[model samples]
Target chain A: MDRRNNRRDAEGSSVITANRLLDGRIVWLAADGQWSPHIRNARVYSNVEIEDALKEQTASAQDNELVGVYGVQVSLSPTGPVPVTSRECIRAGGPSVHPDFTPEWQERPAVSPA
Target chain B: MSHAPHSSLPVGHYAYDEVDRTFLKQRVAQFRDQVERRISGALTEEEFKPLRLMNGLYLQLHAYMLRVAIPYGVLNSGQMRTLAQIAQRYDRDYGHFTTRQNIQFNWIKLEDTPDILALLADADMHALQTSGNCIRNVTADQFAGAAADEVIDPRIHAEILRQWSTLHPEFTFLPRKFKIAISGSPQDRVAARFHDIGLMARKDENGRAVFEVYVGGGLGRTPIVGVKLRDDLPEEDLIAYLEAILRVYNEFGRRDNIYKARIKILVQALGVQEFRNRVNAEFVAMDRARYRLDEKIVAAIQARFGVPDFDPAGQAAEKLIQQRKADRAFDFWVRTNTHAHKQPGYVSVTISCKPAGGIPGDVTSAQMNLLADLADQLSFGELRITHLQNVVLGHVRQDKLYALWQTLDQNGLGTANVGFISDIVACPGLDYCALANARSIPIAQKLSERFASPELQREIGPLRLNISGCINACGHHHAGHIGILGVDKRGEEAFQITLGGAADQDTVSIGQIIGAAMSEDETVDAIARIIDTYLARRTAGEQFIDTCRRLGTAPFKDAAYAPA
Candidate 1:
């Protein structure tokens, strides 16, 4: 969560993201430090808040609640936080071929702390 | 030679012994404990990722993917049934056969992996060394023992290599993942040349089995055809030679850069002759007796692969000929899907998983169940998974062929496109894979649909079109006559074309890139244009690869990049 040590060039708003450890469902860190399935509910961290959020999410990752934890570049729009890269967008939206498998389609609930 | 009676035959060909069973059981127990630790917050994700990877559990886009190794593509009916059960219980109701002769379950849960692994252990199977930078599954010709022209059963050597490489302390963490493929016949069905080590079985002047070794061939971002390291090494020295080569690679292969870590890049940088020199030096310095394989050990392993009982008289059943005359589809299926067997009144049948508009290499649980029954009834209760993403009934009786075909056709497993354009090899790209840059399944489906007509596919004749979602080359795009590589261009899916590459016989060559990358929509048109160019430029009865060789890539490149 320390931005000074991290190599990412934080040009825009960002969020900590990971796949849930149990089911590998994509999740984002909410403002309340909980893992939320909905990107719309994801806490968009800007400037100094990004570092704090990343640290909190990393600690959560260390608790074995999520796998492949990292920060994703996102831009805050009128609707929600949009992923900066197509890869991240795919991860957030689910695989292009099977929309039914997406967390949104499945109506996944936020994961409680492990 | 007189054939043995079916009643006296072994119950299971290549059945696991006590040691193998114990080893798998122990591995499952260990992994289960590791999983418990990870879940209990003792082991972090960073620490657990590699351990899970070693067990073939990968976190893909949709869910955790568990890759179960099908050793040399060989499996018994009971094992096949268990695979079906696992598909139904632990994963989605289907599994995908990979190019490396493994089965992948896409939708897996981390909590259930230990239980799933225990299930696999019941069948004497494990996901060991399927991932991570280790010696992966050792693949061989699917038609190894059954092919008429094969000089030796490559499966014995493959199994030997598997035992040698499994959990080898020194080579466990290498510069990159290593692959080894063995082919018994002159025809390169296993794509041996495109692997880290390619062993071709040959007989020397003294009429003893030996290997023609080739090294440093791979396909990822940088594709290279393997160079011959030894023309004729004694069968006993197989392990020693392999050790020497691996030791050289382990010592010098690049580890600083992930992209340049494969043995092929190392071979390229050092030059083949220099690499060979180092390997030869290593070989000479090592104590040969320690690594040299004993003839008795080889015989013991070979004995495990029990021969299928075949009818002595090499005559087709009267009913088969009659059925062929009546049903045109059956006739076509037999002509394309079945190959001549060395034994009389027997043939090897390829069960094509690539149905029209279906995802390549996908098999439902019901299909697996049906195949298990078919394998029990028609074949010798054994089936082989081919690298081309098809199943092979290696010892099906000619008399029972029609009945098998009917059952397969009913289950959507009988497509009759074995080597045709529809028999495509594609990787699970962006749809399921986390590392894929673009989607590959849709492209494969589109091509299969476009070439659905059996007559047209036959007329086009023997085209190997492989598609990869990324430069990882899991789809073996580099070896295809027409290769399509999916790349991310400006944050959108685009495909690059390659032509004039082949992976058959002894003439292994890497394809050259054709032109600029094309959008997903434009890719099919570009493929058609290249095929049309081949059709126009071909002289007489030249196959796709033959025509490409004669004219080089100029014609195909021109056609691919031609004006809209």
Candidate 2:
């Protein structure tokens, strides 16, 4: 697979991602097959499990819940699953223009997705 | 003749006849079916993507963006009010006016597009050919009809081009998107020399209309000023000449590399003389009778754009002159925002959307409504969206200037700086656009705040600062006196500054990049230093571009990189 556009680190861990169909909100596939808004709640797949995880998420994505489903690289950090590339980081956090508009900015005091 | 209210009023321009209404209805029905098919899994996303894009539905970072074409930047108050309604009901509470004479709703939904299009069709507007490789909305000078220097109302020809290019079968899927601009005056207000095709209207010695046709000018990753293809083509031969040009481009334009697909690249690769020779050959061989414009049709279009009955006795009221003399701010706005109108006692008012530190080109639903009301009262119910991201009331009576200015001031639309530094042209960068590499709005806001002082802006004097988030140059940064391009360097946002680029005038030149890119924090100071350098070097009464030309980029480059 051509993974050039993905945000993989030295360790090849990745997460299946898409935008929620209705509002175009960024979403990641969790282990329970439901989509989560927070990237930290994403089911991180190792290099070996990546293909299967993507396949399963693709099926879920086609169920009309998500759009533009694809895989993005992530690293299993001590804190949580962290995006590798700046593009993915922007998608995970929100637009860099306004701090108040970020997804995490409002959900800061809430329960940790990880 | 008594002025009618909004409901009873007739818009002076081309209204959709039965045939036009049927065409739009058919298009909407077709799009609705396509949307259903995509939703029901009958079509794959890959298959539906292009189909959706053809109708101007773009999936941006956070939501769907719907771009509605305001053909030739002309709209009546009813149409403007309808746009406000669409923004309030269908998408976000505000819409961004684009440099291409289009308005974009950033928070649109895929399902809601068909209904929104239906609403636009009611206003005799549509989102057709607003995206994908097609003849997009034809742009013209905002002051097309009202400008005193104009030879003819270019909107008449613009409307003609719109009718001919709307879903033209052969040219629908060109190698890349095409844009055409028309200017009626010696002053190139529409940035005519920077489009895929540019048409300038002029009259022959016998007082018959002729056009100076320019081809292959574009601003993208590769910016090029168009070369004149035909100096004097008869106005009736507009369609035939355009067909010949498009045919030549469609046949010979590169389809292999996406980056090299624009007609400008082809023109550059094959030289202007060779390209013009090929186009002339095509023009000679074409069936002239089939594409020739009829005189009756041209007359009808021209009649639609006929000047309204002016209040002959209209003059600057005593109160208005008193207000202007009393209030310095009012005097400044009058001097800057008002343009010379063709009719006596009439002036075109530029309602600036770029209030200090505000987002460029963004108008809220309330502001839109207010503008609609102002248009109805002051400008004979017509308004124009300028390429500079400001709104224009093209037919205001000079007597009512003070009243209109007061209303605009109260509504946060009256900024005294029209062609000044605070009046910035910026694109929706990383904030909303998916294609953007870095943020633009924040930088524009920062710069506007830094140059917020009217005294400072007046000192700066007629400097245009344009910011584009990427190399696409949607904001026309390459045209600004001080151009700022945002790029991603080492996974961080950085800005590259360009000096001495210009558009719209005879000395049209693409800006040259000065020094390396600077970080976001360093950009404001760097720009300030560059301006300081210009102030130090400029001769008395010299503009920013003149100063840059006199003293080369070396001094400005040094100032840009100099330690604070």
Candidate 3:
């Protein structure tokens, strides 16, 4: 089961994403379990692990830092973990219309201008 | 919250007495405490969501959005200035005027929401009833008092409705959101037919003021024009009539499925005759005295909305003609952006928010402050926010229009695109709204740029081009003469086009979807072709919708699906 999960992670992964409570900025779960603005540095979890992890975040310490926390399916691209769905991709990036309103990226780089 | 009696405010709006003022302060304090509880883990997100929503705070794509109601789209200069100050202080230097005649700050922090609400309350405004399942903000004709065609000022009824509907205990948690609109003008500028309850003010056979009440109309996944429930409901029985309709809807509306939860579905399920019968039964059985809209109460509300003192000798016709002929841009602005005023020599000037390549309904803090100053000087120190995402100086004397137009033009507020193809009503789609499937603002900008020529817009004539980011229909796509709905065509951005619909009172109808979804560029191109087809098929004096109805959709459909 572990070997199979490892093989699956090579092609695709998942990350936890939500809006920071105070400012309502989009944030991703990092390796240290801290909410970070940069999506590229988001900690990638396998499908099996993410289900349990998201449950914990959603149920416990929900109001600690974030709101609307949910798991985002991502593609294991060369540079970083990328959100798979268009909606997640938009949340990770800023509004396609307002490039000026988008936050500057850290860790790797912003993947989609859209 | 208590309704403000006719008090200090000069503007003919809902005046706030000391009691109303105190109530607002206490409400803000309570909300502040609720926010603290939410942050401190005393209230879970699940528990706190409804509370925050009740206060009109919504979590959008990037940040918290605060929707502040400009009740019936009316506000004083002081209120407008306060809105500017809030935009400058808490938000990203701008605010968006929505299709429902409310202002939305995009980048609000959750912590700052309480303070913002406090600031708004001081200006005789609140976000309450802007969201939630309860009856939302009551909309009326922007030109209610000023329109030449108006037989009555609907604001009296609108204000009464606003007070009655705000926090009504029985209807607070209805199956879905309920919207009500009132239009005094025969032209129906308010799109009254497309609301959950549409009330049109008119005279009965005896020439007494009465309401032609329409019920169960809505626009969303299911776009429907309301059915007439009462032909001439007596003016005094307005409250009782509305109460009966609400009681029936509240008890019977489906709560099982969100999509099927609207009162329209219930009305459709029961059939028109059966629905009317149910409403009539409730109307007849209710304790009529309890819900009576007393004449004294109505008179007091009507007195609060004092009419502006008109100038008989206003702008000189010859001088205005000279000014129009001198500059073509000024002439275009006058032709497209001005509406007829009841008072001669005066007109209601629409300050177009849909500028070239700018986001529709967006106004910067500087622009807001300037407009407030302009309202003070040019108009009667009052402004109206139109349902079409524009601002109206409803009582502008014709003489001041040229000067007002110039100032607006210099400040990027003057675009003479009202009722033109470029004046697109759009939603904050996937760009900001979490529920949207694709972005709408960028597409609107592209369309504006494509049809940038004032001459081309003039040639196209009056057309309502509305865009919705999703099927939720916040943008009122179904009402547009030509509508565009952005959809997710399996991970790709796509837009479905619809043709031959109008939201105006007389010609109200839903647009039919023309073809399969198109990419952003293709959608713009198709719209251009559709316009061309209309131009080609139209008679000498015919408008877009008339030509569309006559020619049918065959030519436009072919034009839309044509290879680009």
lDDT of 2 by residue, B413-450 (tens): 98888999989999999788878777888899899999
Candidate topping lDDT? 3
Model 1 lDDT per residue over B172-250, tens place:
9999999999998877787777889999998778766798898988899888888889989899899999999999999
Candidate whose DockQ is highest = 3
Ranking by DockQ: 3, 1, 2
Docking class of 3: acceptable
Question: Judged by TM-score relative to the true structure, which candidate is superior, 1 or 2?
Answer: 2
Deviation in Å, model 2, residue B292 alpha carbon: 1.6
Using all chains and alpha carbons, the TM-scores for the candidates as numbered come to: 0.93, 0.94, 0.95
Weakest 10 consecutive residues, lDDT, candidate 1 chain B? B1-10
Candidate 3: tens digits of C-alpha lDDT, residues B138-220: 89888878889999888888889988988899999999999999988777878878899999999777766799898888899
CA lDDT, candidate 3, residue B496: 97
Q: Rank by TM-score, highest first.
A: 3, 2, 1
Q: Write the per-residue lDDT of candidate 2 for residues A24-99, one digit (tens) a residue.
A: 6778878786788788788888866787766766776658557877788776787678877656777788766546
DockQ of each: 0.32, 0.27, 0.36
Off by more than 4 A, model 1: A1-15, A31-33, A45-51, A74-84, A104-114, B1-13, B313-318
